[model samples]
Target: MDKAISFEQVTHTYQANTPYAQNALADVSLVIPNNSFTAIIGHTGSGKSTLVQHINALLKPTKGSVQVLGKVITSATTNKNLKAFRQHVGMVFQFPEKQLFEETVIKDIMFGPKNYGVSDADAQQAAKSAMKLVGLDESLAEKSPFDLSGGQMRRVAIAGVLAMKPEILILDEPTAGLDPRGHKEIMDLAQQLHDKDQMTIILVTHQMDDVVNYASQVVVMDEGKIVKTGTAAEIFADPGWVYKMQLNLPSSAEFAQKLVDSGVPIGKLPLTIDQLATKISQLVAEGADTDE
Candidate 1:
C-alpha cells in the first residue's frame, strides 16, 4: 500500500537550548500506509502526541524529516503554502468538543471548510453530510453547540473535522471523557469512516481494548521511541512485552492467559472477545469428541 505518512529519524525537543529542554521524540521512524487504521499506544508522556503532530506539520522536528502526502517537512521548512497539506490532514484533538465555538452546531461544523475556502453552499452541504456520518440529527443543526450533551458536542466537533474531507484523519483520544455508550459510538463512527469512506485513520489512545478491536496495526511507544510495531495480534501475543512496556493486555487476552494458566488449552492469546469465544467453543467440541 502507498505511504500516507512517513517519519525519518525524527526528533523533537521542547525548549531546545534551555535548561529545561526535554526530548519528546527521539529518532523515531515510521510509515503509516494509506487507508489503514493505526493505533498508537503508550502511557502518558511517551511522545505519542509529539510524534503524531508531525503528520500535518503541527510540530516540526527538531531534527530529521517528516513526509505527509508527498509534502516534506524539516526543521528548517517554512510554513508557507501549507494550507493544501493541512486540508488533506485533519486532526481531532483530545476533548475536541472544547474547540467547538460557533453559536450553532451547523456553523461549528462549517467553520473548517469555510476557512479552507469552500463555497458557502458546499460548506453547508458538507456540514450536513458530516453530521449524518457522526450520527447527529439534522434537527440539531441550529441548536447551540453548548446546549447539547457531552456526547453530542463531541460528535459535532468530529463532524467539523470530517466536513473538511481530509484524506488522513488523526484522532487523539477522540473518545476521552465519555460514557461507555458514547465511547462505543465514537469508536463505531471511526470504524465507519475507515471502512465506508476509506479514510486513513491514525488513532492515539491508551485504551487497549479499543486498539485490539479497531486498529489493524499497533505502534507502541516508550521513552520517546517506538519500542514495537506490528498487527494487534502480533503485539498482544506476548503478555511479557506488554507488561515490560508498562501496558496492559486487552481484556480478551488477559482472560485467555488466565484460562491457559488454568489448563483450558487455549492455543494462543486472543485479542478480541469473538476470538476468545471461538477458541473456547473449539475446546468444548474437542472435549465432547474425546468423551464419545
Candidate 2:
C-alpha cells in the first residue's frame, strides 16, 4: 500500500534553548499506509499527541522530516507555502467541541472550507454534506452550535474538518470525554471515512478497546520514541510487555488471559468480548461433540 504519511528520523523539541526544552519526539521513523486505520497508543506523556501533530505540520520536526501527501515538512519548512499541502490533512484536536465558536452549526462547519478559499455556496454545500456524513441532522444547521449536546457539538466540530474534504484525518484522542454511545459513534464515523471515502486515519488514543476494535495498525510509543509498530493482535500478543509499558490490556484480552490460565486451551488471545465469546462457544461445541 502507498504511504499517506512518513516520518524519517523525526525529532521535535519544545521550548528550545530554555531550561524547559524537551524532546517531544526522538528519532521517530514511521509510515502510515494510505487509507489505513492506524492508532498511536501510549501512557501519558508518551508522545502520542506530539506524533499526530506532525501530520498537518502543526508541529514540525526539529530534526529530520515528515512527508505527507507528497509534501515534505522540516524544521526549516515555512507555513508561507503550506496552504495547499495542509488542506489535505485535517486535524481534530482533543476536545474539538471546545473549538466550536460559530453562531450556528452550518456556519461552524463551513468555516474551514471557506477559509481555504472555497466559495460561500460551495462551502455551505460541503458543510451540509459533511454534517450528514457525521450524522448531524440538516435541521440543526441553523441551530447555535452551543445549544447542541456534547456529542452533537463534537460532531459539528468534526463536520467542520470533514467539510474541508481532507485526504488524511488526524484525530487526537477524539473520544476523550465522551459517553459510551458517543465514543462508538465517533469511532464508527472514522471507520466509515476510511472504508467509504478511502481516507487515511491516524488516531491518538489511550483506549485499548478502541485500538482492538477499530485500528488495523498500532504504533506503541514511550518516552519520546516509537517503541513498536504492528497489527493490534501483534501488539497485544505479549501481555508481559504490554504491562511493563504501563499500558492496560483490552478488557476482553484480560478476561481471556484468566481463562487461559485456568486451562481453557485458548491458542490465540481474543482482543474483544465478541471474539472471546465466539472462541469459547466453538470450544464448548467441540467438547460436546467429543462427549457424544
Candidate 3:
C-alpha cells in the first residue's frame, strides 16, 4: 500500500531554550499506510499526540522530517499545496466543543468547505453529508451547537472536519469523555468511513477495547518514543508489553490467557467474547470425546 504519511527520525522538544523544555518526541519514525485504520496508543505525555499533529503539518518537527501526501513539511520553500494537503488530512481535536464558534452546527460544518472556495449551496450539501456520516440528524443542523449535549457536540465537531472530505482523518482522543454508547457510536462511524469511503484513519486513543476491535494496525508509544508497532493479534498476544504499558487487554484475551495458564487446553488466544465462547465449547467437546 502507498503511504499517506511518513516520519523519518523525527524529534521535537517544547520550549527549546527554557528550563521547562521537555522532549515531546524522540527519534520517532513511522509510515501510515494509505486507506488503513491505525491506532496510536499511549498514556498521557507519551508523544502520540505530538506525532499525529506532525502528519498534517499542524506541528513542525524540530529535527529530521515529516512528509504528508508526498510533500515535505520542513522544506525551505513554502508549499503551494498546503491547503490541498490540509484538505486531504483532516484533524478532529479532543473536546471539539471548544472549537465550535459558529451560531449553528450547519454553519460550523460549512466553514471548511466555504474557506476552500466551495459555493454556498455546495458547502451546505457537504455539511449535510458530513452530518449523516457522523450520525447527526439533519434537524440539528440549524440549531446552535452549544445547545447540544456533550456527545452531540462531539459528533457535530467531527462532522465539521468530515465536511472537508479528507482522505486521511486524524483524531486525537475522540472518545475521551463519552459514555459507553457514545463511544461505540463514534467507533462505528469511524468503521463506516473506513469501509465505505476507504479513508485512511489515524486514531489516537487510550481505549484498548476500541483498539482491539477497530484498528488494523496498532502503534504503541512510551516516553516520547515508539515502543511497538504491529497488528492487534500480534501485539495483544503478548501480555507482558500490555502489562508494562499499564494497559488492559480485551476481556476475552485476559480470560484466554488465564485459561491457558491453568492448563485448560484453549485452542488459541481469543480477543473477543464470541471467540472465547467458541473455544470453550470446543474444549468441552474434546473432553467429552476423551471420556467416551
Candidate 4:
C-alpha cells in the first residue's frame, strides 16, 4: 500500500538543552499507509500525541525527519513552505469546539480555506459542502457556533477542517468527553469519511472499543517508543500483552475471554461484538448437528 506519512529516526525533545529537557519521542520510525484507518494507542505521556503532531508540521522533529504526503519536513523546514502541504492533512484536536471563534457557523467553517488564500465565494461554497457532509443543515449557517449544543459545536469544528479538503484526517481523541451516543456519532462519521471520501484516518485515542470497531491497523507505543504495529485482530488475539502494557482490551475481547473461561469454546478471540456473536452461533449450530 502507498504510504501517507513516514517518520525516519525521528526524535523530539521538549525543553531541549535545558535541565528540563525530556525526550517525548526517541528514534521513532513509522509509516502510516495511505487510506488506512489507523489507531495509535498507549498510556498517557507515551508519546502518542507527540508522534502525530509531526504529521502536519505542527511539531518539528528535533532529529531526523518526517515526510508527509510527499512533502519533507525537517527541523530546518520553514513555515512558509508548509502551508500548501498542510492543506492535505486536517487535524481535529481534542475539544476542537474550543477553537471556534467566528461570529457565525458559516464564517467559522470558512476560516481555514480563507486563511489558505481562497476567495470568499469559493471558500463559502466549500464551507457549505463541508457543513452538509458533517450532517449539519445549511440553516445552521447563520447561527453562532456557541449557540449550538456540544455535539453541534463539535460538528461545526470538524466541518471547518473538512473545508480544507484534506486527504488525511488526524483525530486526537476526537470523541473525548462525549456521551455514549455522541461518541458513536463521531466514530461513525470517521468511518464514513474513510469509506466514502477515501480519506486516510489517523486516530489517536484511548478507547479500545473504537480501535477494534473502526481501525484496521493499530500502533502501540510506550515510553516514547513503538512497541508493536499490526492488524487489530493480530494485536488483540492475545490480550495478555495489551494488559501488560497498561492498555485495556476492547469490550468484546474482554467479554469473549470470559465466555472462553466458562468453557464456551469461542474458537478465536474476536475483536468486536458482531464477530463474537457470529462465532457463538456457528458453535451452536455445530453442537446441534452433533446431537443429531
| Stretches > 4 Å off in candidate 2 | 286-292
Model 2 lDDT per residue over 121-186, tens place: 999999999999999999999999999999999999999999999999999899989999999999
What C-alpha lDDT values do all the predictions have?
0.93, 0.93, 0.88, 0.94
TM-score, cand. 3:
0.91
Tens-place lDDT per residue, model 3, 197-267, is 99999999877778889999999999999999999888887787788887788888888889888988775
RMSD of each: 1.4, 1.5, 2.1, 1.6
Q: Would you give me the overall lDDT of model 3?
A: 0.88
Summarize candidate 1's per-residue lDDT along 198-253 as a digit string, tens digits: 99999999899999899999999999999999999898878988998889999888
Report the candidate with higher lDDT, 2 versus 3.
2
**Model 2 lDDT-worst window of ten:** 78-87
Residue-pair clash count for candidate 2: 0
**Which scores greater on TM-score, model 1 or model 3?**
1
**lDDT value for candidate 2?**
0.93
